[model samples]
Target: MGATDRLDRYQPLVLGLFRIVIGLLFTSEGAATLFGVLDRDATPAGDWPFWYAGVIELVCGLLVLLGVLARAAAFFSSGAMAFAYFTEHQPDGLFPLQNGGLAPALFCWGFLLLVFFGPGSLSLSGVFRRDAAPERRG
Candidate 1:
């Protein structure tokens, strides 16, 4: 098979894998921030933005991971990442590398992709989900 054909055939699988990895990483980040379990300091409870962001990351990340309402979760996550980048990093520098905004910027775009493309085949929603029947008009 040609390279393009091979890539096309495996695209869904690769997208699924990518989504899984991204979800796992995002969840890990939240866990680290909220519970201090993964060699990261816990954000103090009631802290402005960080704690709240951790909550979002945990919930949305799980939703994205399981491919349950992933589009919605990704939408929110993307927005949050954009917010984090603009508010926290953009003021420091214009470039992502210079501003320490790489993660947020990448996540924003990545999640935005998910929001549009949807969770690929290897998902809970795909396994047990059924399309609703169309109603007949009288």
Candidate 2:
């Protein structure tokens, strides 16, 4: 098969895997910041903004990982990452390399992509689709 055909055939699998990985990473960050997993410091539960953001990350990340409402989860995640980069990293400098904004920037764009493209064919939504069967002609 041609390269395009091969890519088309495998696109869903690749996209699903990508979504899983991204979700895992985002979830880990939330876990670390909220629950102190992976030897990372836990933000105080009562802390403002950071704690709230962590909650969002945890919940949205889980939704993304399970491919449940992935587009909506990814949309929220993308916005959160953008906010993080702008508020935390951009003050240091305009460039990501100079400001240590790479991770947030990547997450922002990655989630944005997922928001547009969805979780792909390997997702729960795909499996549970109400109209999965092809229409029949009378």
Candidate 3:
């Protein structure tokens, strides 16, 4: 097989690993900001917007990580990143590089990709799927 064929054969594995890493990183950010882990100050108990965003991040991140309703979770996560970038970063400058919006920008696109492509084979969704036919074959 050629390089493309070899890569295609491992697509599910690569996608799963990518999803896991993204989910973990996103979840860690929420945990750090929400609970004061990782030397970051917690969003005060009643700060509704930030607190709620963190909650969404944490929940969606976990869902994506577990591949449970992953596309939906990824859609929401992508929206959150877009909202954060536009509201917080865009106000400072038009470009991500100028405004330090790289993280949100990257996350927005990454989750958007997941929303379209899905969580892949090594996921709870795959295990619990009712359909007997496989979605892909190598």
Candidate 4:
């Protein structure tokens, strides 16, 4: 098969994988927030942040699973992990032994990888492939 044909053939597979990963992550996070596994005081200063986070996770997770706006959704997901890592995981120090920091850092790093690599040719993003050739005359 030609390059274009090969890419087209594999596009769905790539997208499906991306969708699965993003869906699972978002669903897991949403479940934690909604179930209060990651609990926090909903105080007067910001009463709804946790709730909003939970809802976003739930909805975005579903969207990612559907391969809708997967890149942007993944970016936000990555941002969430980064925020969590910086705020909660950095207490001990820069290294892994410090305050259970390694896991969060690694998670954030993986998210960043997803954001940058962008699910590759195995995504809905790949399905909407933009040809390199310049526009031609009608």
Candidate 5:
């Protein structure tokens, strides 16, 4: 097999790594918002959407990282990012650059991908035996 074939064989591992990185980034974002760390101001508790969104990010990010209920968590996370972009970022301008909504837009689409592709080789979902059960194609 050529290098391309070898690379294709490692797709699952690569996917897992991708998921882990995305999850880690998301979790960090939440931590920064909630704890005022990461050189960012903390969202005050009970703040309408920011705080709640932070909580979702923290929880869903961990879930995605762990590969437990990855799809559901990713779906929710994607929605949260979408909501963030529409309500927060899209307001300033239609373009992400103008509104500073790039991060949210990217996160939204990234999580949406997880919703379809699922966690990969490194996920705990397999060990837990609760991973997505694809219908038998026969």
Candidate 6:
């Protein structure tokens, strides 16, 4: 097959992989929040932000995992990571290693990638394209 055909055939695989990986990562985090596995209230803020973060992670992660609205989910998840990095992780600066804080920065990078690249062409988003072809303009 030609390059175009090959890529088209495997596009779903690529997108699906991205969705699954990111989804699982966020999903586990959400599980942590929903279960209260961590002592969030121990922090000075008393876990107020943790609740919001947990909800976002849980919902967005599941949406992506299900391949439903993967693009939008990924975008918002990226934004969530950005908030974590700037406010919580990066208060000191980009040097995450300085304070054992690479997790948030890494999450931010992953989410940013998801936002720009979009959940690939193999995601539920891709299925939507095939099933919901837009009306052609005159």
- How well is each residue in 39-124 modelled by candidate 6, as lDDT tens digits? 53222323678867888888999888877777678788888887877787676766889755687677667766766666765566
Please, what is the TM-score per model? 0.90, 0.90, 0.90, 0.57, 0.89, 0.71
lDDT of 2: 0.90
Model 4 over residues 1-138: C-alpha lDDT tens digits?
A: 789997887765675686677577776677676765656333232346656666767776765655567667777766776776677667657766766866546545655666665565445445555554467799
Q: Taking the tens digit of each residue's C-alpha lDDT, what string does model 5 give over 77-126?
A: 99999999999999899999999999999999999999999988788987
Q: What is the lDDT of residue 115 in candidate 2?
A: 92
Q: Which candidate ranks first by lDDT, i.e. highest?
A: 5
Q: Root-mean-square deviation of each candidate, in angstroms?
A: 3.6, 2.1, 3.5, 6.5, 4.0, 4.7
lDDT measured at residue 90 in model 2 versus the true structure, 0 to 100: 100
Expressed as tens digits, the lDDT of each residue in 99-127 for candidate 1 is: 99999999999999999988987877877
Single out the weakest 10-residue window by summed lDDT for candidate 3.
Answer: 129-138
User: Candidate 3, residues 72-111: lDDT per residue as tens digits?
Assistant: 9999999999999998899999999999999889989999
Would you give me the overall lDDT of model 6?
A: 0.74
Off by over 4 Å in 4: 1-19, 36-49, 101-103, 120-138
| Candidate 1 segments whose C-alpha is farther than 4 A from its true place | 130-138
Clashes of each: 0, 0, 0, 3, 0, 1
Ranking by lDDT: 5, 2, 1, 3, 6, 4
User: Poorest 10 consecutive residues of model 6 by lDDT?
Assistant: 37-46
Cα-based lDDT for every prediction: 0.90, 0.90, 0.89, 0.64, 0.92, 0.74
Q: How much RMSD separates candidate 4 from the native structure?
A: 6.5
